[model samples]
Target: MADRVTVIGWDGSPLTAAACGALGAATLVAGAAHHLALPEVPASAERIRLGSVDLAARRIAGHRGTAVVLADGDPGFFGVVRTLRGPEFGLEVEVVPAVSPVAAAFARAGMPWDDAHVVVAHPRTLRRAVNVCRAHTKVAVLTSPGAGPAELGLLMEGVHRTFVICEELGTDHEQVTVLTSDKAADHTWRDPNVVIVVGGPVGATEGGGWIAGRDPAAGPRGWTRPAQVYGGELGEGERDVLRAAQLARLGPRLGDLVWDIGCGSGAFATEAAAAGAAVIAVDLDPRSCARTEAAARRFGVQLQIVLGTAPHVLENLPEPDVVRIGGGGAAVVSAVADRRPQRIVTHAGTRDAAERVGRDLSEHGYHVECALLQSVDLDTRAWTETERSVAFLLSGELTRS
Candidate 1:
């Protein structure tokens, strides 16, 4: 007498009596080959193997009688249930949830995951998943067959991160291996795995404690100050010039969201956020995120640092008013242009990268302006030596033509 179709979660375990009854009564049942081979599936039911998820959704949609869709782990968290039960099909699904792979992986690692950022790495969009691993301190990556531990480790080669790869969770072949980012890249791993990146320190497990909404203003602490004010081991005079030029090019205003791509020292983002704009700094290094956080605290500003590589990660963030691409190449410039920000600025160390930025912006309808500035350092001898560099500043405005 149940009116709604049921979507069941099977975690490689024997089906319960309640699940068996549902499966037996189902006129149509769809799941992966591994899931369909289970003994609990009724002999007479029409079985559709899940090759393409969209195709499986169609099979479930066409069924006239009681239909059942089986998925692995929690169907709600990055699973097929969301796709199957959407408005296009108008099929109401009763979900029987199971322990999510992310949860299981974290549990096996003996780590708390409530504060961890969760991402999925499928064949289609693994780069974004890599970016998530780069940007956040603690992350749980639900990996697909081709995008497992080795692949992830390879993509995150230079970044300093600790990888805890949990394979075949809840199954007999279950193995958990902890490795440094470099070590993980060197080894092959099993499919259906989860990759956990511990961001802060190796053993430190705690939330960043960042509250939602605007951060408290550093009272009497001016937001944008001269780079010399942030004197540190890394804050050299040459860096000061670079910081000043970057800030001048970015021109972040109050309430604007600035995307400081390839934020090296977090100087630009820190200065902008101090100037009253909300800043999200993107970098591939976890160490960079830590450094940026420290710099923000020192300068008394709210700057959110995302540990991920760009172009892919940028697609997932909110559109920004201003963008600064301090590194990466023409692809980075083109990606930011696609988002159609009010202004885009890029600093290039090489001539080839500079030309690409100029051409890419022009093609995207930007009133592109490119400039190459070389700053000369006057040392104790009072002899000036110019540094070699080039920058492209592209400004896009409303043009009727």
Candidate 2:
């Protein structure tokens, strides 16, 4: 076990008194070369150049003397502090943090970041981060070498965004540059940087919200819609009951993209959006598209309403985490299953259709569940269980077994 470790954060700024004292007393100091070169590092202390955090932690665990780890910005915010104290190392540490890079970039831009979505880019998950930048108004991306401004700007062409690239923040070599997405794609940027992306109108990129990333009051209170508010028929099927049944199966939540195929009036799309999932409602009818947009507006939820038929229309759209089909029965299910969404929900009109869809999903490596929804007499407003089932709902998830 390592001796008590002091994790000190730097933002090209002067160290706090406690951090200075810790560095002065440290017998073993682990940090980057530049951090070790600082005047505050004691002349008598041994130095370990940091490459991998785990490696440094292991070396520190065997050292019998006090150790100090130096890092950039706030070590607690996506920094090395977690790894140093993680279950593998389990080293006792006291963190002295500085302003995070995201906060520093936003401050330089003179914008409030309470409503801004912050994404840490990685090699594998960069596409999802790009999609999030496309969907939200204000975003701050903590960029790495390959996943930095250049890569992000290339994907954001014609997306109507303002890119503020802050390089070498809080340092003498710091550069703050502002440009369109096109310029960002063409220009080269320095490493160890942060990018603040703002979309929409100049001042409308952010709002006064209580929460950090999402406004809790941005949408309706519940996932079920009131019939009279839609200004059109809430569609053919009884949505409230169906929505209640599918909520658990679909597991719609923030950061998920939910696709509604053959959306009649966008009821489920709007509900899913209000439930914190990004929703895309697809319908062939122009009237249905208008109705979906209107319902989204009425409920204050954001929905991408696509005016096209499914199976073909779904090709160009971003991959979804969940899929809900309202009209196209078995064929649509087959098309969506090919995409390998985490969850799938659709309505089947007959037993044959349900079994066929179930068998198809099973073949596609999904665990399937089917249920016939119980009907309620609308006139009596009472639940009634009968052999005459109104609609059959099927849900599927990827299965290894």
The top-ranked prediction according to TM-score is: 2
Candidate 2 lDDT over residue span 1-401, tens digit each: 65679999988889999999999999999998879989999989889999988999999988889999998899999999889878877789999999999889999999889888888887776666776676566789998888999998876643567899999997889999999877887888997899998765322214475678767665557657666676755655535677667776797876677888887777777777666676778999999899888777766566677888878998888788898888776677889989999889886778898899899899888999999986553434554432233678899998753
Residue-level lDDT tens digits of model 1 in 1-401: 22457888877667777788888888878888777888878889889887787887776777778888888888888988778777777777888877888888888888877667687788665765765565446778888888877777877654567899988886789899998887886787887788898753321224334532223442335434544444543322125555666667667765367888887677777777655565779989887677777777765555667888888988778667788777677778878888887777766655676676677777887776656665555554756554433343334431222
In model 2, which regions exceed 4 Å deviation? 153-160, 180-184, 200-209, 377-389
Model 1: residue 130 alpha-carbon error in angstroms: 1.5
Task: Return the TM-score for each candidate structure.
Answer: 0.63, 0.87
Angstrom error of the Cα, residue 97, model 2: value is 1.3
> Which window of 10 residues has the lowest lDDT sum in candidate 1?
200-209
The best candidate by lDDT is: 2
What's the C-alpha lDDT at position 294 in model 1? 78
